[model samples]
Target chain A: MDRLRQHIEQITPLTNEEFEYVKTFFSLKKVRKNQYLVHEGDEVKYEYLVLSGIYKVFYVDEQGKESIVQFAQENWWMSDYYAFFKQKNAGMFIECMEAGEVLCSTLEAREKLSADLHKMEHFFRVKLTNGYVALQQRVKLLLSSTPQQRYEAFSHLYPDLIQRIPKKFIAEYLGVSRETLSRLYSASK
Target chain B: MDRLRQHIEQITPLTNEEFEYVKTFFSLKKVRKNQYLVHEGDEVKYEYLVLSGIYKVFYVDEQGKESIVQFAQENWWMSDYYAFFKQKNAGMFIECMEAGEVLCSTLEAREKLSADLHKMEHFFRVKLTNGYVALQQRVKLLLSSTPQQRYEAFSHLYPDLIQRIPKKFIAEYLGVSRETLSRLYSASK
Candidate 1:
C-alpha cells in the first residue's frame, strides 16, 4: 500500500505499527465503470480513498438534470461526506467514472479509530479542515467566475481528467451545457 | 468568555482548565454597523465568534453584484476561512450588518491551541466537520431547490436571522432579487 503510506505521510508521517493499526480498518474494493458506490437517499456507509480510478460525485435534480459537483481521481478521497459522518441520507450519488480500486473504511471503524488512536483522529481532523477550505473555495468560484473562466480553471485543476472524462461531464461540472463547453473550447483554441 | 464556554458546551464538554487555556487567546472587539470585518482579497488574520449582532459573508461579481453566501448571528463563527487557514487573500467579504461584539483569534493562536490542548483540538475538529457537512447540504439545496423552496428552507433553517436581517440581504443570500424575495414572501402568506 505505497499509495496509502504516501497519503498518510501527506498529513502526518506514521510509524509502521501505527500504519498497520490504521490499515486494519481499511479494505480494498473494486468498482466497475458506471457502477454506483453510493446513491442519493442512501446512507453513505464508507469514506473511500482512491487507489486507482476516477469517481464523480453528482446529484440529479427533480427534473432529472445531473449536476457534477466533484471529480475524485487517484490520490483524492471521495464520499457523500454529508451522509458518512452524519448518518443522514446522501444528497449526492457517487459513481465510478472509470473502473478503479479504493480503500474503504466504515463509520464504525472510523469512530473506533478515533477513540483508539489520537493520531488517526488528528489525521482526519487535518483532512476535514482542508476539505472545509476546499469547499469554501468552490463556493467562491461559483459566485465569482464566469462559465468560460470556470472551464479554464477546471482544465488547469484537473488536466488529466480533461482527456479522460466525456465533454458532457465536464460541462455539467462547470454548470454549463455541452454546446457552451464546445464553444468555449474552440474560442480558447 | 461566557460565549466560548457556551459554544464549546454545545459541541462538547470541556474542563474549566481546558476552557481557560483556550480563552486566553481571544480578545473582545466591536464592529460598527455597515463596517467590513474582513474583505475579499485581504489577508484574513483573525476569526471571530459573534457575541452579539449580525454579519454577512458575501462576494461581489465583476459587475459589482453582491451575492450573500451566509449570515452569522449570535454564537456563530465568522471568517474568510480560506484566507485565515491558507494565508491567502480572502475570497469573501465579511461585514457587520448590525453593530456587534466578537471574540477574535488569530492563525498563530489557532495553531498553538491545536498543539497545546488535545481537548481543544478535538473540539475544533468536530466543529469543522459539522461545518463541512452543513456547507455540502447548502450546495445541494442550491442545486435542487427552487427560489421559493430555497426561501422556505432558509426560513426553516434560520428563521431567527431572517427576522433580524434586511430583506435585501436575505434576497442576496438566496441568490435572488429583492422583487423575487418579495413575491415569495407574499406567496407564503
Candidate 2:
C-alpha cells in the first residue's frame, strides 16, 4: 500500500525480510461510524494508523462533558498515546466518526522492532520528538490565542476538518462551550 | 562539578575520557539576579544546566506583559527548547530570579558529541525521551485541568519550587494573569 510505503520510508530503509518481519505485527481492522475504539480506564493495547475515514480522541470530565483533544483522518495516527507508549490506563477515549480501516501494532511488537533494528529505534525517537514539538505548539496556542482566533487558525490548518466534525466537538477541543462556539460562529459569519 | 557529575550519572555511565570530552564543551557561568540569559528573537545557541539557584523562561506579549513558560532550579536543565532544537529564533526569554550558576554547552558542541560517539548519542536520546515524557504530562495538564487545579498540581509535584519563584510567574505558566493569580494565592493560603 502507498501508506505503508510512506510509513516505511519515514523510518529507515527496511530490507525485504525486515519489512516482512515488521508486517507480521500489523493487523488490519475495519471500524464502523460512531463506534468506540478505546475508553478511559481501559488499557490501550496498540497504536493505529488510519487507512480511511476519521476518528476523534476525547476526555470526559466528572460531570460527563466530553472535551475533544484531537481528530485523526486518513493517513494520520491515533491512539491513547500515554497508555500505548507508557503502559498506563487510558486517559482519553478514541471513537470513529466515519467508517474506517486501520493498521495496528502493539507494544510487544514495537519492543521487538526496536531490538531488531537500531534504525527502528531512531525512527521512534524521531516520532516522539515530533509529537513533543506539536504538543508544545498546541500549548502555546492555548495560552496565546483567543477562542475565535484558535478556531480560525484550525480552519486555516485543516480547511475541511470543521466541515467533517460536529460543532460541539470543535468547541470542546477549543476549550469552550457549544453555546459560546455558536455565538462565535454566528458572529464570524 | 559535583552537580555536573550527578547529571551525567543520571543519564549514562561515562568513561574518564568521555567525561573529559564532555567537560571541554561545558563552561560554568554565573547569572546575577534580575538579568536575562536569553531573549525572545535571539538565537538559542546554548543549553544550560542549573547548578544552583532559580531561573524563569517567559514570553512577553506585544503588550509587553510577561508569561512564564518554565522554571529551572538546581539540577534542572533550561533553554528556549523550541528555538534551540528547531534552530529558530527563541520563543521565550530565560532570566535569573536568584543569582545562579549553570553548566552550559553550545549547540555545535552537542552535535559534535553526537557525531563523535554512539554512546553519547544514546545518552542524549535517552535524556531527550525523558524530557519528552515530562512535556507530554505538562500538555495533558494544560488540556485537562483548570488554572486553579493546574497551580495546585504544580505545587504538589514540586513543593520546593513554590519557594523559589514568585506567584505571578507560576500563574503565567498556568495561563492566568497577575490579579487572578494573587486572588488564587490568597484564597489557597
Candidate 3:
C-alpha cells in the first residue's frame, strides 16, 4: 500500500486520509508464475496494479499464434480494458510471467475515486496520458523500424524487460523472426 | 464551439457557462486540403480537435516511406501527442486530407481545464481511454492480422475513412502492399 501511495504521488499528491480511502478500493492478491489473471471469454472484473514481477497481456489467434500486447511490471496497470470498462467478456489474456502481488480494483471503483477526489482524477488522467504516448511510440516502431533499430529501441526503452523476458516473446513483440533476433542479440554483444 | 461542447459532452456534460470558459482556451482554424497541421522537427504546441475534416497523423521514415498513425475525422482529437504533451519537437506530421476546421488548444490550456473542472478532467480521461483501446486494437492487428483481415477491420471500423482516403494511403496505413490491397479490395467486391 505504501508503494501504491508512492506511485500515485508521483503524479499527484494525496493527503494521508485521502490515500487511506483510496487504498480501500483496491484489494491485494498474490499472482503465481504462469497464472492466468484474465482469460479470453471470462468477465474482466478488475484491473491489476503490479507491485512486483512481470506479466504479459496478450491475444491468441484462432490458429494459436500469440501477439504480446504489453509486458507490465512494478507500478504498472494491466487489464483487458476494452472488456473492463464496458463490463464485457475479455477479448485477450493476461498471464503472470513471474510471481508477484497486485492490487485489483473495479472500473466502478476507479470512477468513484475520480468523482470523489479531483486529485485522483488528475492522477488517473496523467497516467493515461503517459500510456497514450507509449502506445504511440510502439505503433511508430512497429510500422517503420528495421529489426536492428527495433531491437536497439527496445533495449534502450526497456533494458530491464529485455534482461527479464524470454527471447522468444521478445522476437514476437519486435515483429522480427527468431533468427533475426539472434543476429541482433549476438551483434549487440 | 458548439461542436467542442458536444464532443466533450459525449462523455461528460458541461454547463453552458463552463463550456464558454473552456472555449476561450481554443482557437479555431480553417484547414486547407494537404495542409500540414504539424511537421517533423517543429515544436508541437497544440492538439487539434477536428470540427470538420479528414486528417492523417503520420510519420515519414528515412527512406521517405510514410506510415499513418491515425486518420481522424470530425470530433476526433489529433496531435503529435508525444511531443505536444511533453513540450518537445514533433516526431510526426499531421496533414489535412479534406478541407475543414479544427480547434487548437495548448497543453497549458488542457491542463488548466482538467485542473479547474472535474467534469473536464473526466472528459479528457474518457477520451484517452477510448484512444488507448483503439491503439491496442491497432497493435494487435499490426502484429499478426492478414491483409484481408486488416482491410476488413479497417473497413468495419472506419467506413467513412475508407470512402475518403486514397487506396495508396490506405494500403500504407494497413501495412500491406498496393498489390495485396488491390486483391483485398477486388475480393471484397
Predicted complexes: DockQ each: 0.57, 0.39, 0.79
Pairs in steric clash, model 1 = none
lDDT of 1 by residue, A23-142 (tens): 888999999999999998888889999998899999998789898878898888888887888788888899998999999989898778866766777777888888888777666666
Pick out the ten consecutive residues of candidate 1 chain A with the lowest summed lDDT. Answer: A136-145
Per-residue lDDT for A93-147 in model 2, tens only?
9999989899988988766776566666656655665666666666666776777
lDDT of 2 by residue, B35-95 (tens): 9899888988999989988998878766676767678888888788778878899888999
User: Which wins on TM-score, candidate 1 or candidate 2?
Assistant: 1
Pick the DockQ winner.
Answer: 3
The candidate, 1 or 3, that scores higher on TM-score is 3
Query: Candidates' lDDT values, in order?
Result: 0.84, 0.78, 0.92
Query: Candidate 3, residues B1-189: lDDT per residue as tens digits?
Result: 888887888788888899889999999999999999999999998999999979999999988999988888998999999999889999999999899999999999999999999999988999998899888889988988888899999999989888888999998899888899999888888
Candidate 1 wrongly placed segments (more than 4 Å):
none
lDDT of 1 by residue, B26-60 (tens): 99998899999998888898999899988999988
Candidate 2 residue-wise lDDT at B162:
78
Reproduced native contacts, each prediction = 0.38, 0.17, 0.62
Model 2 spans > 4 angstroms off: A186-189, B1-5, B17-27, B106-121, B186-189
TM-score of each: 0.95, 0.86, 0.98
> Candidate 2, A49: how far from true, in Å?
3.0
The docking quality of candidate 1, as DockQ, is 0.57
